[model samples]
Target: MEHCELPRRPGRLDRLRQALPRLFPFLGWWPQVNRRTFKADLWAGLTGAVIVLPQGVAFAAIAGLPPEYGLYAAMVPVVVAALFGSSFHLISGPTTTASLVIFANVSQLAAPGTAEYLHLVLALTLLAGVVKLGLGLARLGGMVNFVSHSVVTGFMAGAAILIATSQLGHFFGLALPRGGSFLETWGALLGQLSAANPWVVAVGAATLACAVVIRRINPRAPALLLAMVAGSLLSLALDGPAHGIALVGALPASLPPLSLPWFDLDTLRTLVPGAVAVAMLGLAEAVSIARAVATRSGQAIDNSQEFIGQGLANIVGSFFSAYATSGSFTRTGVNYDAGGKTPLAAVFSSGFLAAILLLVAPLTAYLPIASMAGVILLVAAGLISVPAIRHIVRTDRGEAGVLAATFLATLFVELQFAIYAGVILSLLLYLRRTSHPHFITLAPDPASPHRALVNIRRSPQAECPQLKILRLDGSIFFGAVNHIAEELHRIVAQSPEQCHILILGSGINFIDAGGCHMLFHEAGAMKLSGREIFFCSLKSEVMELLRRGGCLARIGAGNVFKDKSTAISGIVARLDPERCACCHLRVFDECRARPGGEDVE
Candidate 1:
């Protein structure tokens, strides 16, 4: 027996229930919770918390803030992101990239490790969060797609190099001046090499060696945490500070303290540009990484929701003494690999990080600055994606050029402008490629038994005396309109006797005002010269655009044909019988069927 399914009408309550999940995204997954997932999340959360301990401190140092702020950032923002963002595996925290960007943009206005600097950092975070929230609300998450892969790869490589270079002073125990350009920093470091302390270098080297060995032995090992532990122990054994080695000092233990960001107009003005940069970069990085992880985990992600999550995290985190926080690629990958089952893992990690800090805050007194430098150097090293660079260089010259330019600009120029340069170059090159679209002449294929059209360049077929067949293979936007017009003019110039033109319109995807105006003028000129223009296989969208622009009326609806065979028959019926009879080309069956033309099919 066959059964008919009836459409069920949703009541107001049912509709409201469905809308709840969209508004509060966590509700979608909360009902599916099980013991197995809870256990997995517990383990994943513990792993992530341990991992963030050293990282938070290192990233905080990079951002020119005190050590405790990094942990604070890792806590509040991370939980907020987990509760609100779409990605189950993404862990928001004090990332190396975000920290580096913050320092680069803010260091010029205030001294590092000072009251004024902290205030600026807080304000900057707030502004960036506001910007991000606005963008998410406006549903502009698709903007990240415009930032090309080459640009990101190049920018990351440059940022990595800068990260490593910046840490050279701490690693080598040199009192190098901060806030200098890349070259200037290098120059200052070289000038102060004689003043380098051997004990500090040994501490950094030991940390670096431990991390490398752990990673080589087992890639899944928490190499950073292990290295930091080893370095801190070594520092304690040697009494590092007695030998002129700097230490991170003890961080404050307990919950995040609530504080308002400075709202001075002059300070806000100074931070606006950097805030915008951070907001854009953070969103792009988060969305890209979220999508990438979702590919493996088989999870769906909403970019706009992710943007809002990140924005709220930073906005709320600013009040809790956290600087700008974003999605950390390294931690997110670790979280996924560690069997994190849901956003609960990230939420638990954030909560666990705060609790762990309270218990182990004093232990940081043994963690030398050199050890932090070593960890950051490793981070910088990881950012340089060798495979990505090699692939770009070996595969595409255009993208390689973009990569080279972006990479160079990132190293030597203002980092924000480097992103712009890459995006602009990508667009310009794309337009250049599309503007000069392929305009190939078609002829009947002699190789095929059927009368099929093929490019004249590849086939042995003759052109008809009174007809011209052309193929266009791109959009008819304003940028391409001139070239298309020139090609059309050239076709008429080459074959003046063939007054009727039939264009294969299947390849044309779009037609704008400029394209319509050009077509109108061409059609009018052809009509005046006692000729006609026809379009074969024109798509519905192009037809609609033409109709709306009044080009279809001028050209006549009867001139457009659905298929090439029908178009050929229609054009053949209109061709002069005398010309067809005298023609020896025999390109069409109608010509062959005429009196003088050879009857070849």
Candidate 2:
């Protein structure tokens, strides 16, 4: 054997190129980071940390988990999502919608705040992560487009109402039965209004009023965090525990502790359906928020990569005592406003959150539940977009119907069912519209110098006595084939003497197998009945499909024409000689050379 070394071992650069897709995206940004950007990221991170403390507790309360779990969610998941995700400003953590869904689903199976409830929530996080990762890897980023914006707005509006409803008892200091329906929850509140603890109600009201006033004073200030601090100090002044007010306990640890998601077969089976709903909703939220922020930053977002980042965040977070999370619209806007330059801003945010928690965790022992409720109530209110709702309702009846249906379903039925209902309804309406494509009859116009095909009804032009020309103005798939066939049959039945048929297929954008089979069979039937059928201006893609389906051969390739002029001339040559002689309408230039040989006066 020749002593030639088996092709020189691949260099690091060559190996790196081969492994590009598998590598973390943050590696590419490392070179872009500099001192000024690092300083900007640190300040942005600090702002994010302050913003999340109140939010984390509020969201956790909504999710039926301990207050600390919310803080934990903002930790590892935020870092992982930023490092792997495509958006520079997107910050991932627990969100209002996700939290509400978690409480709605898991609370049905186990008591809120119980160990069993935590396990179910963790399982859902794990399963949802797996599904999200699969969708990303499969490159189904465009799948989210199927979810209409109207449906999303309606669903969120409904969730927002539910969130506000769920917080009423805490805000009012009344102990409410968990998992009650919306109407039932309100009914219960009505009966217990007089029993609310005055001290707790005062704390909640003052916190809410303070947040509002502070926002008005300085739009960019830490209104949520400052209002919460004010509420905590007020509670201390009112002797909160002595006044029968409940406090969110101090966190057990500042660090995200190691944990394992519930992997029990029974638990996984139970949570699978909910996990799917959570994954889809979270993915939609993350992608939409990312793209919206990208518009401001002039950054191009990779939707599939975002899906992968979200999946990994939730998956990794599940093992570190965090719940399912998605990109935060509010936090991302804040990051962009604060001039964050890179994904490192998000990484710094989580780090700062952990460091700050060490100093503030013990202070939470004085943080009233009512104060968290007030902040959450504000968030819930923001979720409902009245202007957007009005726009949808005014501009589109179909979209309005979807919004109403989803909103009602979310309030009355289970949250996941609401998503399914909206999707199915929209799809059904779409199918109904597509199944009945326009079947326009066309004729050659006499007014034009060069004969032009125009709608018969529009121009009132004469058509050949022995040939019926039609233009199908839509795709012909399984759904529309029957409608098309019935229309053709009706036209034929009405004009039995018109034995020759020509289809102008320029308007047929697509034709599936069912469409091809339909044309083939119709051609065979016409041939059997001593008639002929022809098609002209068929698109190349449609022609190729017909050819591949063996339809073109069965229908006779000779009968397929390239243009209206050619098709008219060829079909005219085949028309009954006696009919052509008797016919007065010499509608085509080719027809003038035949029996009806004069141009229109």
Candidate 3:
């Protein structure tokens, strides 16, 4: 009996079903499970959770919230970010900068640790989520491009300094004034130098030294955790309270509780500004880190998707008693280094954190504030990329200026305003550079036998008597129209004898209405002078612009050519033979073939 061949079934529907959850993201990584992966994910998650223990409490303190809130922020937001975000390694949680900014802005309106303050924090988180979600839905992912690399570099450098400085009170165990500017903090530290507690200072110094050494010798070492452990032991050895040292008190054992943001209009109005600041900073940090990792991994990350993920994370987290959450560069780097293969690793990290929290919540009370300060110091040090800063300074002066300005502004001025300043400066500098396109007169090279090399600004070479060749090397937009027009007029004035002009239009990438008008007027002027304007190797887009503007008709279609040789030949044929007979210069091969043409004696 012959068996009939089985028909192949298409898995189109199956593939579609698999892809559907990628947009929502909760279902994307659920299917990729095995014993090995589960174990790996569990370990990665535990590592992340352990890492956040001290960090969560410290960040919460910085944000003017109770210690538990920091843990709360880390718990729910992390899970949401991992589930929804596109990056395999990007773990979202409380960041020091975001926390500090939140405290500085929100503390002005409400008392810290009060119910009103918590409500405001929730409102800020919700608003930030809404803004981020709106941006993602609007496909404004390209907004990140508007933030210059220099601005980020500068801002991060300033933030590093600020972070380090902010921890000085705990680092030295000094009762320093809170919420002061960077300079003010430094001044306060100097003024209160005599009040520094030796025991706290010793713990912080020891922690920092240990972390530094461990990181240098073996980067894989859990330096932060180890340093915290060392500091805590040192504090206990000295009986920290006896030496006027502060400790992080008992932490709550429960998971984040479900809550809603206050719905008062006045509360919303008060929280909006801070929420905007938080959203901007959070998105910047997250998107920058994601892009950096994406570049190295050869993975395409959707910024819009990232925005949505972060927005959802924050929104979900707010209800779960979490403050604003953002991408953590440190954790992301760790995730990548740990060989995390996909977003599942991040999701697993969240799961691990939740499980670890259940077991290790009580142990966090023993972690000293000085030890956390030491970790913050280490993080601050990491933020200042000396090599990258040096490269920026050496390569581009304009960018360096912007970087310096942003750095200073972020330190002295409001953080939001500083970012705005950097963006504005970046745009201004860009406009200044592009407003004057390079308009160079081109001549055949005498040194090169092939006559291919074109000179700009400085050319000792002679020009052809009839045709003047120019290269316009930039977009001919409205901003550049005046500069180009002036340059063209100047070129014509300098070479009055050369009546015909041939523009090598290959470099003219774009032409606006103003630029087209200027070109038309120039062509008209040349024609009135009994000469013709020609374009060789003109791009089709520019040609269309000229055609639509009726420039080609006025300049004559015969004047336009596709190649240099064709243009030279055509111009030679139309040359005033009477003028050519008396002309001693022979600039073209066609001139040598003319009846009156003779080799230059």
Q: Which ten residues in a row have the lowest lDDT in candidate 1?
A: 592-601
> Residue 265: error of model 1 in Å?
9.6
The candidate maximizing TM-score is 3
lDDT of 2 by residue, 1-601 (tens): 7786678899999998767745688877778899989887887787677667767887899899998899999999999999988889899999877998888789999999999889889889999999999999998987766667777778768877887898899999998887689999999999999999999999999998997898789865656667878998999999999998888776655687898886678877889988988899899878866765665578988888999999999999999999999988567755765568899999999988898778776765787889878876776676677887999999989889999998999899966577678888888878987998887888888789778888888779887788999888889999999999999889888888888889889988999999999988988888998878889999999999999999999889889999988888888888777777777778877777676565333
lDDT of 1: 0.84
Lowest lDDT 10-residue stretch of candidate 2: 592-601
Write down the RMSD of all candidates, one decimal each.
Answer: 4.3, 5.7, 4.1
Output the lDDT of residue 91, model 1. Answer: 90
Per-candidate TM-scores read: 0.83, 0.78, 0.86
Model 2 regions lying over 4 Å from their true place: 1-22, 27-67, 87-91, 95-131, 170-175, 192-249, 260-301, 323-345, 363-375, 386-391, 394-396, 445-451, 456-464, 529-531, 572-599
Q: Write the per-residue lDDT of candidate 3 for residues 1-601, one digit (tens) a residue.
A: 9999998776999888877886776576667766776665555565566667767877899899998899888877887887787776788999877898888788998899999889888888989998888888788888888778788788777867876897899899987887688888999999999988888889999988987888788765556667778988998899987777787765566788899887678777877888888898888878867765665578877788889999999999889999998988667655654456667767666666676567776666676788878777876776676887899899999999999998999899876566678889999999988888876777676567656536635756667787788777888889998888888888788888888888888888888788888888888887888877888888899999989988788778998999777888898888888888877767666777664786553
lDDT of each: 0.84, 0.84, 0.80
- Candidate 1 residue pairs in clash (backbone atoms < 3 Å): none
Better of 2 and 3 by TM-score: 3
